[model samples]
Target: MIAAFLLLLQAVAPPGVATQVAPAAPSAAMPTASVPLPPQDWSGLPILPIRRSATIQANTSMYVHGEVMAGRCAKAVRTAQGWTLTLDLAVLATPQGRFRRVTPRAIDCPTVEQYAAGVLVGTPRDAIDLDDTQTDTWYRTSMTFTWAGS
Candidate 1:
């Protein structure tokens, strides 16, 4: 399943774009269980039917599109997990439009996943084909978050 998921990511990713999975770290107080992702189905394909450029732009906008948080740092930041997180997402077609679903290839922190999902879940730039004959064409996307240190 892991191999299939990686291959799907490679097959659908845009040119020059790379897919990375964040590594997990051990913690004295962290839980041993893992977060669950949506089950794989025909809708699990990585590439979306929408224009790739537009989708890319929208996804990128999620990071720097909000208010600036300058010079307020030097504050103590701590987590039971690693500071960086990488997540695999699938944009699926829905009656309302597009829905973002996380296919948790690697998730070390539930908080990080929740934060990312809140920022990410939304309709795609273009509508996906809803035809019954469609192969459930899905888009594969990844997001990585890295702290200033560690």
Candidate 2:
């Protein structure tokens, strides 16, 4: 009777049924989360241009390279929070290639004078001056125009 019962148990069970079942694994470290988006636009809307003022300055050797060079000043307009102004040492007709350098005090004018003179916010050592090789080292600068709310 005992041998018959053992034969019945062996027939019901598989060879390695205990080994087949694995223990549950602990969960991984909590995954990192993404940053929240700004409360502004999420739709693929093109940004409408804000009419900010612009001032462009070119180097002394600007016209020597057979290129038309000029310094430009544009008028400022009012904005919602505050007005913003832009100053860039840009090339007019030159493609994605070499151009001239506009030093910090290079293009001094009444418009950019107060901002430049107040306190150079973020320029590197000695301002954006000419190196021995004469390439434009892009040091950063920023200022707030509080005089006329611009």
Candidate 3:
């Protein structure tokens, strides 16, 4: 049983270095531009948890409310508690595991975009992990802000 367990562990662990393979030559019939790109692989990237702060939550709620009231965004659905704001973002990380950039998808609300970027920027370095083989890559992530009691 112990030998089998050790074999399983070895299979699960990443190899010290990845083997490289050359790309196949393109055929004359198919154009590279027409080929659909594969979706990004986010398996190894860290998923940072949302750290809620009362002050930040209050400010974001106020900003969201103002945006809704000013006709900037469609009326937000409000529950007995309050409204929820979600931001989808792509974060670029360097080979050294440092976060380089935070890009938020255009949601028509500029302040909200900035808020999401701010949250990503405030994340500590220790929270992210990167392997030397990853190089520079963009990882997709999201944050949802939910305020209760308006």
Candidate 4:
């Protein structure tokens, strides 16, 4: 079931985009028995889907397009054909799949980092499947965004 879910997520992701997941540091106070075992293959987790929001999409599109058109990211080799940005996010959620926070690791481009964080923040709480056995733990996930040159 997890395999299927991951495949479905990859199928829906745009070209050049990828997702990976990892367990965050466990709290020292938390009982070992209570802490769920982390998945061996962290990269196999499904990518969280962004919520349907025209405003967010439009804003992201405009920002990325503007940056590409202006050649703001052209210096990077990844921008030769276009621009590619990878964002690493630390996500905290409840067992019920409610998102508590989505924090992005800083990148060279502050604006892009901010946008990536916003995208995660805009994702639906239940987008990620959290079983009853899950606890309130942080998960590390990465998302890559690519845009073709005009």
Candidate 5:
């Protein structure tokens, strides 16, 4: 379990690290007009289906990335609760890939807590099974969102 969690943490490594999906670029076939016209309908376009695992990983990565890039997590100190706004998240699953519910736990920082909760709740997620029953898996981790130096 610890090994799995560690691997998950590595999935959200800092920028310059390689990931499976390459950054999207404008296709050569696309028009080079100064003002691009908006598509009237998206039904003709190909829809890329992403796995739940991938979605979860991407969300985690973006959460960390946004905080760091915005300088919201500078000069954080390690506390008994692990420095960051450590949250225990329970992401419920549904067919629409939307989270039926989300609950936060082990939150110590009120500001970070409110922000994280607003972001996580009602998000897309996959259902995890425990034993014979299906349930949501709780992901717990610490994260810093303080800008002390600035």
Candidate 6:
């Protein structure tokens, strides 16, 4: 599923624009279990639908056009049981309308270590698609994440 997302991202913004977030230190913590994505009947080929009025926000003030967002992403982990990968991620889709203010770097997610070390972990990930409508000011997307390599 991630591969398909990556391919879509590539088609949208190219691989160079797509970024990743890795733990400062690899953890031995294994994934609890693996869950598979559900299957659904479709009329034709698998295609992610786009939203025309989508809104995405970053940081405390950054805003983007959700229509331009090609895809979302998360982390990659491995479990001993099934080599299961635990992906924790966030995404933000830019809104269509213009914003009074926007800070591109503010949307990034910070590292846990950075926070623990007393550093104000600013935007750790380049962009975080907030699930909260009031806080993030964005809407949820149809990612349909399916477990792979399990």
* Per-candidate TM-score against the hidden true structure: 0.36, 0.22, 0.54, 0.50, 0.30, 0.19
Q: What is the lDDT of residue 10 in candidate 6?
A: 37
Q: What is the lDDT of residue 125 in candidate 3?
A: 55
Model 4, span 111-133: residue lDDT tens? 55555655665454435555564
Name model 3 segments beyond 4 Å from true: 1-61
Model 3 residue 2 CA deviation (Å) reads 59
On TM-score, the stronger of 1 and 3 is 3
Among residues 3 or more apart in sequence or in different chains, the pairs in candidate 2 whose N, CA or C atoms overlap within 3 Å are none
lDDT of 5 at 105: 44
In candidate 1, what are the lDDT values of residues 26-106, reduced to their tens digit?
A: 488866434223456534464544434323344332332221123222222335553433555554434434342434333
Residue pairs clashing, model 3: none
**Model 2 weakest lDDT span, ten residues long:** 90-99
Say what the RMSD of model 1 is.
14.7
| Number of the predicted model whose lDDT against the real structure is largest | 3
Task: Put the candidates in lDDT order, highest first.
Answer: 3, 4, 1, 5, 2, 6
> Which model scores highest in TM-score?
3
- Order of candidates by TM-score, top first? 3, 4, 1, 5, 2, 6
Alpha carbon lDDT at 87, candidate 4: 66
Candidate 2 lDDT by residue in tens digits, 24-137? 234577453322222232233222112343232332112111111123433333467543343322111112112122222323343353223212221222222333433322
lDDT by residue for model 5 over 52-101, one digit each (tens)? 43234445535544554566644335455433334443333333333333
Encode model 3's per-residue lDDT on 26-82: one tens digit a residue.
899856432222235544655443344223546656766776667776536677778
